[model samples]
Target: MPCIPRLSAPHFLSIALAAASFGAAAQQPQLSAVDLARKNACMACHGLVHKQVGPGFAQIAERYRGDAAAPARLADKIRNGSVGTWGRVIMPRQSLVSEADAQVLARWVLAQPQQQQPPAR
Candidate 1:
């Protein structure tokens, strides 16, 4: 008969700690669209409700509403960058963002509530 070797208390505790740490990392929450935007520095030139160096997210949503192709177009713009669409302010290419993530971000931007325009005097 073969006998199994038993681990010492210290070795057992070390193995448990390593397993716990691995589980903690694996169970970490996924980043939301807003969080992803911040992580990728999208918030630097854009805002949720107001324009900064770029148009607000709500504004983009309003502009693209009912346009079925907007999602794909926006996603392309996000990954490859765009120029002159919103005047001469060029949107630099975000090569770091994966295609799937860019699509997620585009959908998120397009899902923002439409901003109310001010009444003309």
Candidate 2:
């Protein structure tokens, strides 16, 4: 006969607590950036990873890596519109998207993971 080990009370309590925490987290609303982007139609031109009409958020992050002022600059670009920076595609001025929202979106983009290029020999 195979013997089965019984879980201790402390172990069971910890498991229950972890499950509850996970459930709570799962019930929380989507990240603010995602919600804002969805509400403003930003996803129509930009994606988290792959390129849409504009460069991917990750690519933007990579391009501005190590720049301390990137967030502020990106926020300005979001509001004022930019062209010739990423080909002939023109980013129309987002007058509807508030400055605060633009800042939040820029921060979110900067937080995304950048693709690491392999080191050259």
Candidate 3:
């Protein structure tokens, strides 16, 4: 059998570090809807409970509640952008977000709970 060359301590350490990093990266958790929204800047204009530049996530959920087509409509709006739906606020197109990601975001927005109204005294 041919003799194998031994790896030096520095080479072994570098290889080990690279392997550890690769494993860590591979084991990273999947991105949730909220994470995806934040990554795509959706949270910049829409908040979970209150409106920012646009309507809140809960408000969108409330508005589209019981509507079967809401998901598709919202996804379309997300990808292509929209206007007049929420008055003069213009939702610029998010061309960088994938179709699947847009759908996920739409579903997430639709799942938000409506804000509770104060009880009348």
Top TM-score prediction, candidate number: 1
The TM-score of candidate 3 is 0.76
User: Please, what is the whole-model Cα lDDT of each candidate in the order they appear?
Assistant: 0.93, 0.90, 0.93
Give the per-residue lDDT of model 2 (tens digit) for 5-61.
899999999999999999999898645998998898888999887789998989898
Alpha carbon lDDT at 15, candidate 3: 97
Task: Point out the worst 10-residue segment of candidate 1 by lDDT.
Answer: 109-118
Would you give me the overall lDDT of model 1? 0.93
Each candidate: RMSD to true structure? 2.4, 12.6, 3.2
Query: Least accurate stretch of 10 residues (summed lDDT) in model 2?
Result: 28-37
The alpha-carbon deviation from the true structure for residue 90 of candidate 1, after best TM-score superposition, in angstroms, is 1.0
Kindly provide the TM-score of model 2 when superposed on the true structure, using C-alpha atoms.
0.69
Please give the lDDT score at residue 18 for candidate 1: 100
TM-score of 1: 0.79
